[model samples]
Target: MTEQHAFSSKVLQEDCLDYTPFLSSVTLARRRAARLVSEWGHPDIAGDVALVVSELAGNALLHGRVLGQLFRVQLILTAAAVRIEVGDACGERRPEVRNPAQDEKFGRGMVIVDALATRWGVVPRTVGKTVWAEIDLR
Candidate 1:
């Protein structure tokens, strides 16, 4: 599968559950999604998608994760591009690109994602919004 990601990739999809207010699990899932894309012979692109997933997943957890609610991470790799989607139990917040000052030690994840992704957007979900990004593989 990884090889295919590197060479002639097919559609790739993976799901990971979001537990309590934690980040370790989501991080691993994003890496796995990257690995799947790498298998398709697109390690570089996979890495890009993985990073986006990481940031989005983190955002989902940080700003969207709520009490008694769970978040979900999904990665899709098509022939033309790779898409990353992260959904959480949020309904009152939004994501935007920010510029972090020199002293700031956090809050720059989305900037990186926005720079790498060819296209990105947000979609309304039952609970919250699904933040997504697409990276061209061709």
Candidate 2:
């Protein structure tokens, strides 16, 4: 039997945004990430991942409180899994998981992501932190 090739790709690097309003840029980045995953035969996972990226990136922009540091988003797919990575210049701060009541508005993002992601974590780089999540594709 012939072996099927795995797929992996890196985004062209988006420009960082000011931490004032966090809508347009975050949405755009999430869309691109979703599209990349969809091409790898996981459109279902893409939606959940899109939201995860949005929330993580949003937090980085809104709460991490850094300036002029463009974020990097990367997608990697293999026979067993698909991985999403979002890197920002907020190495000093790590993201915290929160639990909210059924009627609560905030703190729900990470909860949803945790439920969907097979694995997730925050990795510190020399200058920043990378928030990553992985979904099983099998």
Candidate 3:
């Protein structure tokens, strides 16, 4: 009799998009995030993922932009969840969840991120910081 064996493998899926510090970058980032989420086999959570990406990328452009520097958006897909990260060149300005006034138009980005993300925080680097948010698809 011949013995038979089964083979299995695990692979990590990840991608990144770099953008200039232009205000229009936020729109591009959100669009790309939605498309990538769908392409990464998570169409079910594409809406939430895209919204989070918009907030994070908007925050980076509004608060973390530095002259002559660029920002990056990264996505990591795991078995149970997806992680999104936005890296910018301003380390001093950190993200915070603020309750804006009724008439306020801004200061709500972090609030939205906090409400949707399973977990989110900031990661400081040598020259800047990366704000990351994770969404559970399970």
Candidate 4:
């Protein structure tokens, strides 16, 4: 099932998907984000946007899992850019690049996000924080 939020943040279109903090939810969020962005007429960036959502959602599940709390994945698309936001229930832990060694098997999600997105950052919310990335479609 899918649900949307009542938001009017900008001139462009927005879509939101909320899910339980589970390992499988990350893949769900990624697929939803790709479909939404493609429907919004930005198919070229669907893969990147999906990757960003996966990374953020995976982080939420792995690091920000709060009992009885749900996370959110939001996509905002416009003529020039597409913004993806993933909100989780943990606020204390912030996202950063660890610059792991080349042989490390993990710690590359955010690095991939940084390389794919034009800009990305985290915003602290009342209960948690939202990690967002914007990709230029121009």
Candidate 5:
């Protein structure tokens, strides 16, 4: 679903989708995020937004999946930035960045997010947590 909010006279556009906790949802989330960003007149940041969405959604699937619970992806757009948020039911399992060996094949999602996003963090919810990243449009 989509909604528009007004904050300090600026219109903030938001789109949210919930996905079943599955590996396939990661790809879906990435594609949807890219399309929404592009459609909102920010094609230049779509690629970066997609990458961030992929990482966050993948991390949610891998680390935040709870039985029978769905994860949510939300995109918030303003004049200056776009924020991507992934919320899952497993709140206790927080995400952390790992420095893996060069030969290691896993563990670099947050690093990629950190590099691309201007800022990112976790927000605790009553049932779960929302992991979010923001990319500046300037």
Candidate 6:
């Protein structure tokens, strides 16, 4: 049997936005991701996309922020999948999935991201890094 890929190389639809590294930006990113996925005719995955966007964007704001720099969110839809990417201006920091204590209030963002996306990874950019997650449509 042939192995099925989670995402196609050909992009069918794409949307991108840049936001200031602020707390509100994470909410905006989540909303935008859900709307874009729904508009692209994949409402079933909208909630998952939104959740992943929230985690990635929140991580960028909290750990990857640089003064005067904005974090960017990009959504790319293919026939078989949707990919969400959050780019920030700090390459030195990398995202990690941590298992926090039961009473801990934070450190669960990457854990959520890891559980939701079919596949996720970081791509190093010239000045920073782009954290990306993909959800399969099939």
Q: Estimate each model's TM-score.
A: 0.82, 0.76, 0.89, 0.88, 0.90, 0.92
What's the C-alpha lDDT at position 123 in model 6?
81
Give the alpha carbon lDDT tens digit for every residue of 15-109 in model 4.
Answer: 88799988888988888888888888878889989998999899888888899999999888866678888898899987776799999987888
Query: How big is the positional error of residue 46 in model 3, measured in Å on the Cα after superposition?
Result: 0.6
Clash pairs, candidate 5, are none
Candidate 3 global Cα RMSD: 9.6
Which of the two candidates, 2 or 5, achieves a greater TM-score against the reference? 5
In the predicted model 6, the residue pairs found to clash are: none
- Looking at candidate 3, what is the lDDT of residue 29? 88
Residue-pair clashes per prediction, in order, are 17, 0, 0, 0, 0, 0
Ranking by lDDT: 6, 5, 3, 4, 1, 2
Q: Pick the candidate with the highest lDDT.
A: 6
- Whole-model lDDT per candidate: 0.74, 0.69, 0.84, 0.83, 0.87, 0.89
Model 1: which ten-residue window has the lowest total lDDT? Answer: 1-10
- Output the lDDT of residue 122, model 6: 84
Model 3 lDDT-worst window of ten: 1-10
User: For residue 12, what is the lDDT in candidate 6?
Assistant: 93
Question: What tens digits encode model 5's per-residue C-alpha lDDT throughout 4-123?
Answer: 222232547899999998889999999999999999999999999999999999988988989999999999998878988899998898777789899998789999998898888888
lDDT of 3 by residue, 1-138 (tens): 011112122326788989997878888988888898899888989889899999989888889988888999998887777888899999999888888999998999888888888888888889999888888885
> Model 6: which ten-residue window has the lowest total lDDT?
1-10
- Model 2: which ten-residue window has the lowest total lDDT? 11-20
Model 2 residue 94 CA deviation (Å) reads 1.0
lDDT at position 65, candidate 4: 80
Best prediction by TM-score: 6
